[model samples]
Target: MALLEVHDLVVEFPTRRGVLTAVDEISLHIDEGEVLGVVGESGAGKSMTGNAIIGLLEPPGRIARGEILLDGRRIDNLPYDQMRTIRGKEIGAIFQDPLTSLNPLYTVGEQLVETIQTHTDMTPTQARARALELLIEVGIPAPERRVDQYPHQFSGGMRQRVVIALALCVNPRLIVADEPTTALDVSIQAQIIALLKRLCSEHGTAVMLVTHDMGVIAETADRVAVMYAGRIAEVGPVKQVVKRARHPYTHGLMGSIPVIGHDADRLTQIEGAMPRLTDIPTGCAFNPRCPQATDRCLRDRPEPMPTEDGQVACWLFEKEAAHV
Candidate 1:
């Protein structure tokens, strides 16, 4: 069975104007030890999906509909205390900003030890040793001394490593890494991605990586799901999705990539901006920016249809033309 299965998840925010649907009936699955990359621009609902799964969405935003299943058990409806028990034990999360996730007042060692002790039956000494070991494994220098320092003392990259160590404290079965490298420099970004991939492989942890960088998805993901507006526009194997993109939005993204020999006056860009959650169009959400959009696209929403190599939610690949 898949380690995590999200079915028809919908999260909405109540506004003075009306209810805005940030995520609409989105569903996906991650199997044990597999890396599923959820890629899209900002406001694409990727992070919202992660937050919903971890039960971290605050007031104003709520789960309008859906099921978050972990190992065949439904978790979305669990009580607060029961869900708290699962949050760190069954699932771990690493966000874009390490400092925001880590407590400023506490020593890094204290937070890590607290997490380890909360989820496991380890004694204080054992937890302390494990915490130090994890900090070193994540590439933090002077694991012994550094552990005693506060979050502000570490560099951005070093702090992020500590965050990774904290997430792995419970030996979670699933890891939700929501743009974990977004706040770092390019040089440090690669290192963070490598660390996540290596640790997941070593611990047999399933990962759902939400990011805007296609390069990161191509490099770290076994499979890719592209979200447009609030719904999935395309999904399939990473290689097939990257090299043989079927959705117009996906094609536009690839066209913008700076290739070695391709010399163009300007980098190709998707012509328009994504619609606001409050002003989503009548039919296909991407029709306004999609080059291949037709009248049918603006008049009727196209369901996700199977392509030869992938699945895309666009009229360009209508089933009537598939046989021909």
Candidate 2:
């Protein structure tokens, strides 16, 4: 069974103006020990999807429709307190900024030990020991001494490592990591990616890695889901999606990446910005900006259709399938 399953999820905010749908009928799944990268532009609902899955969607923004399941059990409709218990124990989360997640007043050890104790039946002393072990596992040097320090004492990279440790403290089956490396320096970003990959592999934990950085997705994710205007444009194995993208948007994203040896006069860019949630275009959300869009694309939305190796939500693909 899939470790994490999201089916037709729709997240929305009812404001004075009107209801704004931030996420629109998106569905995907992550298997055991798999890294599913949700990549897109800033407002592409990547973080919102993660928040919905982890039961952290802020007030006014909620799961308007559809279901979220973890290990075959439905979780989207669970009560707040019940979902809280499931959050840290069954599904962990690592966000973009470590400082925002960590408490400034407490020692790192205190926070880790508290989380471990809350989820497990371990004593204070046992929890402390496990906390230290986690610190070491995340590659924090001098964990014995570092564990006693506050969040402010660690560097950006090290603090992120601490956050990773906190997420894994309860041995969660799945993790929702939203731009975990975005706040670090480029050099540190690579290290953190390697660390996350190694730790997840060793623990056999599934990860829903949400980011806008295609480079990071290429490096760490097993499969890639390209989202556009709060919908999935294409999804498949990372290599296939990266090298032979079937959807035009995915192709544009891959083309935008800079090559080391190949120097081009200018990098490829997808024309026009993503439409605002309130102003989403009719029919295919991407039709306004899609170069290959036809009259049908402007009037009718296309659901994800099977491709040779994956699925693409495009009329072009649908027509091709019909001819075949």
Candidate 3:
């Protein structure tokens, strides 16, 4: 069975304007030791999906309907304190900015030790040793010295590595990484991606990687889910989704990625912006931005139907003959 399953999740915000649906009946899963990349442009609900899974939805936002399961057990409905325990023990989260996950008041070792001690039964001395090991494992220079330093002491890249160390300290079954490499430079981003892939592979941990960069998803994810305005446009293996995108939105996204050797006058651009939650378009949320959208696309929403190798939520692929 998949390690994490998000079934028809609906996250909404009660606002003065009206109820805004941030996540609209989106469902996906991450298998054991596999990385499922959730990719989209801003306002596509990728980060919201990740936040919902880790139970970090902002106060005003709440799960209006649906469920999130971890290892066949429902976690979305658990009490805050109960979910908190599960979040640390069964699932870990890595955010785009490392500082948000780290405390400036605490030494790197202290924070690591605290999380370790909170989730596990390790002694203070034992937790410290584990923290040191984690620092070394994440490639922090001078693990002994750096462990005693504050979060501000590390460079952006090193601080990210430290956050990674904390996330993995408990060896949780899954990690929800929301734009985990965004703040770092290109080289450091590659390193962090490689580190996440290698570590997850080595330790048999599943990951839900949420990012707007299709390039990063192409590198680190085993499977890709392309989200569009709070819904999944397409979901399949990385190569399939990247090379043979079925949904127009997915195709537009793939075409926008510049290939190093292939020259083009300019990258493909999807003309329209994703709709705001309060003003999502009818039928297909991406219809306005989809170049190949039809009359049916503007009036009839297409549920995810089977593709040759995956699933796509587009009327163009509604029939078997449409499979490429």
Instruction: Tell me the whole-model lDDT of each prediction, alpha carbons only.
Output: 0.91, 0.92, 0.89
Cα shift from native, residue 143, model 3 (Å) = 0.7
Error of 3 at 12 (Å): 0.1
**Which candidate wins on lDDT?**
2
For candidate 3, lDDT tens digit of each residue in 124-143? 99999999999888898889
TM-score ranking, high to low? 2, 3, 1
CA-RMSD of model 2? 1.2
Worst 10 residues of 3 by lDDT: 315-324
C-alpha lDDT (0 to 100) for residue 208 of candidate 3: 91
Please list the Cα RMSD from the true structure of every candidate, rounded to 1 decimal place.
1.6, 1.2, 1.4
- How many clashes does each candidate structure show, in the order listed? 0, 0, 0
TM-score of each: 0.97, 0.98, 0.97
Can you tell me which runs of candidate 2 are displaced by over 4 Å?
A: 320-324
Off by over 4 Å in 1: 320-324
